[model samples]
Target chain A: MTKPLLTVEGLVKRYGEHTVLNGLDLTVREGEVVVIVGPSGCGKSTLLRCINALEPIQSGAVRLEVAPISRESRDLPALRQKVGMVFQSYELFPHLTVLDNVTLAPRKAQKRPRAEAEREALALLERVGLADRARDYPRQLSGGQKQRVAIVRALVMHPQVLLFDEVTAALDPEMVREVLDVLLDLARQGRTMLIVTIEMNFARAVADRVIFLDGGTIVEEAPPEEFFDHPKTPRAQKFLNTFTFDAVKRPHPSSLADPTT
Target chain B: MSIAVLRDYLPLFARSALLTVRLGALGILLAVLVGVLCSAAQYFRLPVLQQLSAVYIELSRNTPLLVQLFFLYYGLPKLGIRTDPAVCGVAGLAFLGGSYMAEAFRSGLEAVDRVQLESALSLGLTNAQAMGSVILPQALSISMPALVANVIFLLKETSVFSAVSLMDLMFTAKDLIGLHYNTVESLTLLVVFYLLILLPISILGSLVERRLRYAGSGT
Candidate 1:
């Protein structure tokens, strides 16, 4: 019954002859955690990028809170202010300190005073237990720490929705847990999030709905339990089967909630 | 080889040194300004400027510095465009150095992960703000060693100012040689003067290079 916070309608994106996203449509209500998983090169990352307006769609529309998101119709920076995206390769500004990195957008885009920006940034860093590392540079931190700092950077803007484009893909196996814990905490805090990840367990634990995409279209969508335990589509079954029996497995992504509760 | 030669020429050398420093500083500054515009134009594919930048970079980079100097200093006068010799010489160096500077800048900008721009945009920074605040700084750090090397090259090449009749260090040395016929001594003194001016800059360049080594490569 609540208003949808985000909507993607008949979205189509292409790179020359190849179509990366094809006539995709979805809607998310406020505070829903939607996880997208598919085989490599299946347009999962492109879909998230299109939502953020980083990749311009060839047709269709993306809207946030009843407003159309288009290059011609909107002030992009202002639109971006409402939707924050964290990249797969933690693109932290290497030249600035971590504190500066967190505060740059607030100071520049929102024109917040320095002390106010730093104060807010410090609190967010403290939330992630990175307050002590505020003075360190991006190069000084590990992959997990850099991604965590990146998450805090996005949070400082108080965006309406957060997008993660495979944020844990670059991490060491040991480091993935630290970053996922942050995501789990954000989900528990009731934030609206769209995550593109291969961590089957994390999706199974936190996703309000799991979307299995193949060849640029959603093959199946359901609650995680139903989707994982009983994938209805042949494409979904095949995709999961490939990962189901690999010997060199990624460390298992721990569970988020105890279903019995 | 006596103390008198050193003492007598010190003031003149000081003045010539000042002149060289002033011209070198101005030329390098102009080169950097020209480089920023040219490389940005190329990156954005700005209509006419991009083509102009490409032609200018290639022409300047390929031609000998001496010919460019002669063309600007001498050829322009006959075309009813007389300009100051110092202006012509500085413009020439800037043109030549800027071409190389643009290459350095282009590479540096490319060295950055393209994802950086997307992230910056998502943070609500406008394209200009993203390029200026986030992208340009990393590019600068990566491009610095090449830029500094270009500057050192410019300082040495400013010796060509003598042919243009500009009062650069090499010009002053030529005049001293003409007056005293102490060719070896005067040239040796000029070399010392150049070393004194440029060695410190070389040291600073290396220091900066060391600091920036690991900064731009982080994820």
Candidate 2:
């Protein structure tokens, strides 16, 4: 558990003149779940992207296990294979059936046997409750089902670490639970994951450690219970208070209890 | 009187239509191949190839196919490059058709959401693999209607092949009108033969577009 499976040191990401992630540093040990909470445009998503090497950084380095991941890295494909990422849009390959989407990378990139890849993909799809949708295209699936298929697609890669960039942000209310439940199951299984999300209750329920980020930096990091009940920083308290205020002030008192949950 | 002349020229019209189909198919095949290559060069931003593709597309599109065939068959002989009339016909049609096909593919490639590429990269696909397996299929589907339109345009453009002396439908029509003075009958036969070759393709294009629309509905 103490072994750092993934590490980001002083990562600096900028688009043109605007800097998004400013000298950020973080580490994720093997079998740990870290949930990141932040306001929109605070660089939570940027940090995850930099770690996955999907976005190039101006400075600093990201490492999975021992090897550094960078644009110049000779083995970027192999390096990226070890880091699975799920996007908020559930970017399943729209042209492919769910099974084909899940099996594509394994068979094509890794050069695995098609039958073997399909078998593993079917098992993962079954786990995500999408086994029946194996023949269906992305357009045929609902939001929750599509996200689950996306998760299966990532899991089929057998990555050393996973990054979830607001995975449930775009899902409808009822669909949110199905996706979060999948994440909670993965957490219970001790999968190493770094998640960026605004769902405070899900963050509290699943995080081993909650990281509060603001203005391109970490403002606070603590255990879930401690951070949720008794945030140390004034900024953290104010952010949490907004969620509470929104919940209390809303006119609809119907099934809106703990709205984020 | 016209019906009797049309019956008399049926064999000549059939032969001419066959030649036209063969030439049009060859030209469209070459055009599609060139189009995919040029668009790929633009999409991937290949060094000299991208610029050359841009120049070729502009030059080919701006000039007429008849002018291109004339240059290939007539003008090139002065420069000691006498190409066969059939080759000139196919090449001229390809030159014109390639630019339109490339533009169609480029638009389709651009319309694909950026997330499609990003997600493929996140899943460990190499740039080539992502483009080939993920991006190209979606782009091709999106480009279907434009490609069908280009195919029809190229086939119709095959009418100019007769100027280079290839004995196509237009040449057969002109020869019959000159010899027998049956202009209406020859032109009617020409129209019917062209429809024979083009109507099936138009119908097939619509069917494919509907299927693709169904598959790509929510996307």
Q: Write the per-residue lDDT of candidate 2 for residues B1-219, one digit (tens) a residue.
A: 567787889999999999999989999899988998899899879999999999999999999899999989999889998799999998888888899999999999998887889889888899889998888888888899998998998999999888999999999999999998898999999999999999999999998877775367343
Q: B194, model 1: CA deviation in Å?
A: 1.5
lDDT of 1 by residue, A1-261 (tens): 667999999999999999988899989889999999999999999998888788778999999988888776558799889898999888998889999999999999999999999999999999888999999989999999999999999999999999999999999999999999999999999999999999999999989999988888888999999999999998898888887667566655554344553
Candidate 1 regions with alpha-carbon error over 4 angstroms: A246-261, B207-216
> How does each model score on TM-score?
0.92, 0.92
- Model 2: DockQ score: 0.59
Can you write out model 2's per-residue Cα lDDT over A59-92, one digit (the tens) per residue?
A: 9999998999988888888888889999999988
Cand. 1 TM to true fold: 0.92
Q: Report how closely model 1 matches the true complex, as a DockQ value.
A: 0.70
Q: Native contact fraction of candidate 1?
A: 0.84
True-structure RMSD, every candidate: 5.8, 4.5
Superposed model 2: Cα runs more than 4 Å off: A246-261, B2-4, B210-214
TM-score of chain B of each: 0.94, 0.95
